[model samples]
Target: MDIKEKIRNFIESNLIVFEDEAVFTDDDNIFQMGFVNSLFAMKLLGYIEQEFGITVANEDLDIANFSTLNSIVRLIGKHKQEV
Candidate 1:
């Protein structure tokens, strides 16, 4: 699957949404929506690094980069380009 699809799947798999039809857009703020927590961020960081084969710099640990699907994709794209 592509990067966006992979990220979406990973997010969905970890979400504990109460509504069966709950949906999130690429720009949605997952943290604000209560779909995930801070701990999830660490897991996401590890996943992004391992899955994309790029290291997340200490300076790149900003929550804004991982707060949404689109942002996460952009962050990975940035790191991949760096490699």
Candidate 2:
């Protein structure tokens, strides 16, 4: 229902590989967890923009912003404030 839970659900649902869902946490490094590939990050970027109505700038695209639920939430908050 919250942002973290929404992100966690989205990532788990979109995962290409079937791994133990229990392995994910709000702060889990999704990339390090092997939950996504590079292109998937782009897909997630689009989802963030559409779902949160925030545009992520080119400079903001990086693992530091997309690698965890909490980080994505932070990125969304940052962009929302810029609106």
Candidate 3:
């Protein structure tokens, strides 16, 4: 699968509530949907760095960049471009 698909699958698999799997969409706000907590955010960061081989900078830790699958994908793209 492509990066976005990979991310979507990863997020879907790691959702806070298992039954809400199908409820997540690319544009959906994960935090607003109560999908992310502090611990989960760090887990997501680790996943992004490990899966994409790109480190997320401190300044880039803004929740906006991680609020949705689409945003995360865009953030990864931005990081990749910078690399």
Cα lDDT of model 2 by residue, 36-82, tens digit: 88888988988998998888898998778999888998998888889
Candidates ranked by TM-score: 1, 3, 2
- Model 2, global lDDT: 0.84
1-83 per-residue lDDT for model 3 (tens digits): 89999988777777777664558778999888887666778888999999999999999999899889999999999999999
In the order shown, the candidates' Cα RMSDs to the true structure are: 1.1, 1.5, 1.5
Better of 1 and 2 by lDDT: 1
Question: Candidates 1 and 3: which is better by lDDT?
Answer: 1
Stretch of 10 with least lDDT, candidate 1? 13-22
- lDDT, candidates in the order shown: 0.92, 0.84, 0.86
TM-score head-to-head 1 vs 3, winner: 1
lDDT of 1 at 59: 88
Quote each prediction's TM-score. 0.94, 0.87, 0.89
